[model samples]
Target: MDHQLTQNLEEYSASSTTIKFDRPIPLLRAPSRPGLPMTLTGPYILAFKDLPSWAAAYKSCESKIIAQCEEGARIGCAITASNKCKPPWWQSLTGWKSMDLKERERCEDREMEDCLVSAKEKCMGFAKEHATTPFLDARIALGEGR
Candidate 1:
């Protein structure tokens, strides 16, 4: 089956997580980005080794992800109990802020970078640990012809 869809993007910030790099990080010889399906159409590739590591990564980061999402949601909440909301991306943050949009974005980006410094190190550690494991590439051209 041939198909395609736009990738949804979101933004936010929090604490207790960091990933950084002093030099460029290669794609680890993977055909595509890690944990992402090869294409919009068919030809999905999943390696046995990757499955465990993928699950482990998510498991390791799941709580952190949820906590941050909840915090975002709370910030977006309408009530004074916004702290009671689920998360902004999930439910959307509706509160009004007095700061400039560009400045807010810059702040988010800076905070994100700060938190990811350690995360970058962690990813490098994983990539080094799995340096030997192969990541299969699956990409194809479609539509009219080649």
Candidate 2:
């Protein structure tokens, strides 16, 4: 939604090729549900019109990761606070003990990293299958040579 993001998407789209696809490619979009954590949203996958759409989708995916991480931090803080006091037996039995603060944070970080990696892989794979030259050239122009 930011101007910079829009500009980046426009630049990437403009620099990328204009190859036509038999069918529109699916690209990932952020979850529509309010307060729905990205972790529960599963993998990054959706539909896109062109390189600009792809760039936008990719940015959305990154935003989702950040949201998930922040949510995890909030949950961790709540758990830590509860642990400081006396939590109910049911709460204690909920398996929160199995994952300490560090472990939980690490798990969330790992999940976010995995999601981003998956998105990058999917993007690259799609470009390779559809318009390798344009995609690569745009990446190079954006100083993201590969």
Best by lDDT: 2
Cα misplacement distance, residue 64 of candidate 2 (Å): 1.3
Per-prediction count of colliding residue pairs?
Answer: 15, 5
Residue 36, model 1: lDDT of 52
Model 1 segments more than 4 A misplaced: 1-29, 32-38, 41-50, 77-79, 82-146
TM-score of each: 0.24, 0.26
Q: Over the stretch 10-99, how does candidate 1's per-residue lDDT look in tens digits?
A: 122222234564987543123333345344434443333345555554454544554555555444332323222223453335564445
Local distance difference test values of all predictions, in order: 0.42, 0.50
Task: Put down candidate 2 lDDT per residue, 38-132, tens digits, no spaces.
Answer: 33324332333455756764555555655555565556655554454443568667766533667656655665555555555554455444443
